[model samples]
Target chain A: MGVNGAYACVVRTKVASTNGGKPMKDTIFIKPGQMAIEDVDKPTIQAPDDVILHIVRTCVCGSDLWNYRGIDATAPHSQNPGHEAIATVDAVGSAITTLIPGDFVIAPFTHGCGHCAACRAGFEGGCLNHDDNFSMGAQAEYMRYQHAEWSLVKIPGQPSDYSEDMLKSLLALADVMATGYHAARVARVKTGDTVVVVGDGAVGLSGVLSAKMRGAKRIIAMSRHEDRAALAREFGATDVVAERGDAGVAKVMALTNGEGADAVLECVGSEQSVDTAVQCGRPGATVGRVGVPHNAKMDLRPLFFRNTQIAGGPASVTTYDKQVLLDAVLRGEINPGKVFTKSFKLDDIDAAYQAMDKREAIKSYVIVD
Target chain B: MGVNGAYACVVRTKVASTNGGKPMKDTIFIKPGQMAIEDVDKPTIQAPDDVILHIVRTCVCGSDLWNYRGIDATAPHSQNPGHEAIATVDAVGSAITTLIPGDFVIAPFTHGCGHCAACRAGFEGGCLNHDDNFSMGAQAEYMRYQHAEWSLVKIPGQPSDYSEDMLKSLLALADVMATGYHAARVARVKTGDTVVVVGDGAVGLSGVLSAKMRGAKRIIAMSRHEDRAALAREFGATDVVAERGDAGVAKVMALTNGEGADAVLECVGSEQSVDTAVQCGRPGATVGRVGVPHNAKMDLRPLFFRNTQIAGGPASVTTYDKQVLLDAVLRGEINPGKVFTKSFKLDDIDAAYQAMDKREAIKSYVIVD
Candidate 1:
């Protein structure tokens, strides 16, 4: 099949007659903004610990925008793109004893084998036994999850008990929400700390919630967009600075009585955003950045004089344990699903990308039937 | 006086005959190898808690070379330099209670007032009551120390008991040794961890010792110079990698079975040095840099992927408490003075700078008596 016209073919090929010949399912891909829905073979258990997931919901992430915007040049053309996901167990391998068919689970962006050194150390994102990222795109109808017992977290209570909003919030635990929590955790945000979160994206908004949950007394969100800024306040931001760059830092410093924030959360991953986050922090403060850094260079001279520490990386979402976030959602503690400003059907993936790309949506959810 | 020819007017001026006539002293200055030794008005007790010291030993630091090589553009022409010193208390203010005449002390590069928030928090380098750096040059015969009680660490026993080598070693604890300790401590170098020290300067050599003292099992020192590399081994480096940049990183990775060191001490503040330190560390590792960063920019992209934390600043030498190091010196446990490869009389300050600037000396000491 030609790479360009491969998506046009929806032909289903039967691999095993004994299993009633499950048909291949369609999946979305994009080269920058160009989208395609291609029929791919249904995932079959290749390992004893593997599980086949029938994806129910998936969401676009700011990191995905990096590839969609062609910023990540190495991202392959027609590459399957989504990672944050909620799915039902369609099939489980012999060794997968913790989960069974019909179980709802949260699939983290990265999955690790249970026994890897990194996984054992609680940094599954850096798992040695795995490639340290999701093998299959979760935007698809079906995904083959390796080391499923360790990689997928079963949602608490029955799958039928969750409302669409609750499920969306729980689904956020897969990536954005967990990533924000990692940011706050790494920054060592404590009670009464005044935190300044750079970026008003889904991750940044989620950081406000995470910091609040961590007992931060004041959460300052840096945002230029009115809609996102309002959402940031709703997510527990005590203040919002509308400026950018030096002026933004100045505003935060003024708000912080000229000492800068006690902790900074850099969620945007842009050079400017990182710069702002660093500048908005006080002496001996830590800036935890979860953004997939794009040409971001932190000037060590200034940071050194201030004794500032920069600590963060890709969030080990699996280590965060989705059950905790799911429990929080069930108790109405945090509504992370508020970030899902737009929604789309499986086939209308183009609209989802457009809304996110054009800044019309904070985050767009894809509902798969 | 005009800034250019100000140093030429070095004629000593006698002041305060009632307190026993003290003549103004000569001090050295350089703007990119251009040297000058000029007489300046002697410092007297400006504050009630100040103490005047007669400097006995002072050292040239690698950081001073940044200004001496014309790399630090902001460095003033004929600026009074030198901060590391061992001195005898010449006079004390009315409010001074820590010491009287004849007491020997170690003067750190930065002094804290001890009452500020940063000082109270053990970050004396970021003291709010002071300018966060040495107020007087230590290379001169006489210097005034503010916040004397908190800034100067008194030498145990008597001034006459310390040998010249012991005094030099104790002088090192004021800056280089303390800075190295800060680097290792911030990097979280635990027992049995593999550590990489990224420079061969006095600070780097001291870092090797500090790491060893901290119980690091394998310390890798990155150095190309035969003499410094040999000293690195003496300072407890288990391995020495002479290559730089990618080759240096490759060597470290090869030594660690492609996993990289658990912690990296960046004792060189150059961009390349910082980059190598970041690359030489494994996932969840940290790079503690205290080399006075000059145009050092940490690329956050690779660091983010590796989950690397970069934490460091000017070593709060006072916070480390020189008493701990002094006792170690007294017990002959660690000889940090081994770093001083060249010595000079007070008049030969230019030669000291030359030896350090040309890398002929790992560190140079000047006898001020």
Candidate 2:
């Protein structure tokens, strides 16, 4: 078996233990620009419908940098750090109906009650009855997952039945890949469309994969990093626009024969990236955005004049997990796991965050056993 | 023949005239809050692909108030005053291959080249090669029209062949009805959807008609004016909200079982109206905005979290005229003309503006024959 997130193994036990009032060895923590692997009280079922998940593989997300890099203020330190996870149920509450302990699962990061208007409309991320505490970070030995009866998807077999790559791919369905797919889906990318993806992050690369899968004839990925650019091409990018801002728009317009792309994906939320994404749409085109808007103040006036639409938001991971991405991943039809370029043992998660912060890895995967 | 705008008759002659530097009774002019009928040089084919239209009927648009009511600045006085036109082609330039003299037509206000990306994509309102001079005010004896070979829709028969009601319906297709339809179309209003229309203007009433025609199970029209509310109901609104701002949103939510509407049409662009429009959308709902934003400064941040898409712009009248509405009007399936509650003779054009300016009429109709 591959250890430390090359592939994390299956969960088999539930332990009764305490942190002993010290930073032990299993969970991750973050305080502005710094991170650590610490011990925390092992989770138990906290709600009637909740379950305790023994996380198999957990990975760092780009949004984690919002707090870790000081873009968003947080407490002096936070015990919770990651969101994506491929896990096995360790405990179940009385209200659980569909899921059972020891069932391998991909937990949708934003726990959703599938009966809500949003979930029924295919945007489970905006579920009306969501409980925030259900998504306690997955970067630990155990975490509470609510909405298990409706949101969590059971994987087909035990961890040993799949390869390391398949494990990481399943982990991706928890957030990143689903988010990228949302961009393409919302933009209504169609066959023979020329699409522009504005960002070089793992999410943007995943967006390139999504557009190609949706039948876009050409995908132009905006990336300057050699490694990310290569991966973007591997994900089906037909061209790369290394420039940004006005220059980047000019490059896209030139590439599209002065008309701009039929659909544009805005995967980075800064004002610059969003503006660039909007600028790259042809008249009657749409810009699908997935980045958490940290500095975005969009004015709808210009979009109104061009007949361009701005759509998409946080990915409905549960929708994608049960309906699309998981099946594709298991069938080896896609390899989104390549996005996890650096891996660490749970004890070395601080290094995982540091590598991603320094751009040393596209994403950091951590194994907790 | 119908004497004035409840149903203006066909154009029989193309007049060659001199104003003698005096205001005359044929063409309308506006300066600040005042309006007058004036005479100007009669139009002639100005470009190779142009046509001179003998205007039969025209009207005051809600947007005309932007300049008359001082929301938008104007040149001391503007000779051009209206965009909607139901006319007959008086002359065609040498390059006009499809149109002939005396052809009854519905001129799409924003002239479009049928082959441009915007036109091909069904958003001819954003046509790339539009000429400013083509759509000179149609509230006159004649106006110069461009892109005649593509954008102008030829009505099926002579003006006299249709009843007064049919004439009014055909005229509605010029702008008002098509615009409201654009809002519904862009919002993707589907069967069984609950639609919210945010405005009391003629366009909003038309939107009520469109939502119903699109099979929406319930249409909530936000209108406080008793007369407009009655009109909204006649156009198929299932509910009426007589509140503004937050109250309007609240009423909509309650009517929708606290989940909000599946699609919202922002037909008025005041900040409060736009805010109400966005607030009325359920998660995954779309807000289609067609009003020219005089005071709208929409922030996309909140919409991002709700998965609400804000789309739409100027109506692609050419697209709708040629593809759907005109045919429906001809078959007597829809009557968008009831929006014209007040009519005036060409010489009473000032009264037309005054009545609409003071909200005495939903829209003012003028006849020029």
- lDDT (10s digit) by residue, model 2, range B177-233: 999999999999999999999998999999999999899999999999999999999
Docking class of 1: medium
lDDT of 1 at B45: 88
Q: iRMS for all predictions?
A: 1.9, 1.4
lDDT of each: 0.77, 0.80
Quote fnat for model 1: 0.63
Q: Fraction of true contacts reproduced, model 2?
A: 0.74
Q: Which ten residues in a row have the lowest lDDT in candidate 2 chain A?
A: A1-10
> Which pairs clash (backbone N, Cα, C closer than 3 Å) in model 2?
A24-A39
Share of native interface contacts recovered by each model: 0.63, 0.74
- Deviation (Å) of A201 in candidate 1: 1.9
Query: In terms of lDDT, which candidate is strongest?
Result: 2
Error at A267, model 2, angstroms: 0.1
